[model samples]
Target: MSKRNQKNRQKQKVNYIGGRKSFVRILEEMNEQDPNLIRFYKEVHWSRKKGCFITDTAEHNYKLMLERLDETEVNTENNNEKCNAAFKEVLGHRSGYAKELGHSVIPEPSIALHKNRDYLRIVEENERNKN
Candidate 1:
């Protein structure tokens, strides 16, 4: 190919990559700010006039993006559950230790409420008091 043609191809490649990256980044920000908007985007069909023109490739990318978003949400929930369980286990050990030492044990917070940062801080403060 001529040098001019090669340059054109390189420019097109860069534009394609940049466009795809920006699309994903924008979607992530939108998801973080308002997940309902992402859901609406996924559900609404776009037309050339009403919404932005969407090609077959763009449609496929949208599907993939939604799938990734859903997977990420599920993974996050699982991680949070695991973290809460670990916290509960630690609290259990602390309570047992206090019982052994004849120190009055602080009442454990409900499992559902353990996700609160304030609750975690209170537990940490109680531990420090014991030490």
Candidate 2:
């Protein structure tokens, strides 16, 4: 094998290790034509070799693409009326906001914690009053 092919095979690392060009071609074909092929292949051929694998049927690269798409995201300028407008206009409601995991916006840890804290505080106060 040539050095370039060797390099490609090596780069396929987590999956597709020995099938680089064909691997990428499959991705393009699925994206351009039909996405169900990816799902079917993954359902049939996916492997635990990559911890990121969601199913055993998908082709290696197709699974990787799904992972990338799931984790991918969009950029926003702000979190206000203008931002909301842009989100609606450019992104639409349920289209491009989420990553593969399906969340368009990831809430900050602090925000989640604060909400949790508020809920706990309310519960504690209510319990104390009852006692």
Candidate 3:
């Protein structure tokens, strides 16, 4: 074989170690500081053996994790909408009262709404129990 052909073959060769490192590096990069992505990466049972992630079990589990993450995001968005509507309703009622009394009522300090982490934990526990 010519030197050029040998060089081409070497260039085409797969570096398994480098490829493995890149696979993990790419996943980390795609995480983009999202809590869900971070949790998914941390929780998943990544195998050290070559080709383990391509197995049927690993693929199915990964798909399920992705679906769960999507569902959680949708649920969070829905909850946020509900919270905003409720807050608006409360503010409207307060404003109407102030207007009826013909006085400038001092507005109360706004309390920031936050999701209860324990609620999520309970829901997850219940789901696991159901399964």
Candidate 4:
């Protein structure tokens, strides 16, 4: 096969943890194993026209999910590793958006900063302008 064909084949391979069924299965396992441990799982949707990610929370929870996945066993197969890869991709996209808005890094502001509604508004406005 040609190099291009080989690359296409690689892309066509099903990602074990990228699918919703497997992702939720792993999350449920984690939750059942330990209810005390906080695990935030949300379906992340991206809007091409809006040029941003949309979720229930106005905040990106990719980093937190990644951190928890690193500590916990997400699946029986090698799916845990693939899940991490998927979340990392989301984090990369989010970081790109942050950079475009002139932020040095993705804002994980302190509690005090989060409480400052004016500051958040300004930051959000900057993101919209950049988009």
Q: For model 1, how does the per-residue alpha-carbon lDDT over 46-112 read when each residue is reduced to its tens digit?
A: 4535464245544554555555454544555465444334333332334444332322344565887
lDDT string for model 4 (1-131, tens) is: 69998888676422222345444445556656642112323332334456654543322454555564666666657554556455554443454454433212455668899779999999899999999
Error of 4 at 83 (Å): 4.0
Lowest-sum lDDT 10-residue window in model 2: 78-87
User: What overall lDDT goes with each candidate model?
Assistant: 0.48, 0.46, 0.45, 0.50
User: How much lDDT does candidate 1 score?
Assistant: 0.48
- Stretches off by above 4 angstroms in model 2 are 17-35, 48-131
Report the lDDT tens digits of candidate 3 across residue range 52-114: 553454455455555544454456646544433433333233443433231224444233322
Better of 1 and 4 by lDDT: 4
- Give the TM-score (vs. native) of candidate 1: 0.24
Residue 18, model 3: Cα distance from true site in angstroms: 7.4
After superposition, the stretches of candidate 4 with alpha carbons farther than 4 Å from their true spots are: 1-44, 55-59, 72-76, 80-131
Once superposed on the true structure, which residue ranges of model 1 sit more than 4 Å away at CA?
1-52, 74-131
Evaluated against the true structure, the overall lDDT of model 4 is 0.50
Model 3 clash pairs are none
Report the Cα lDDT for residue 128, model 3.
Answer: 100
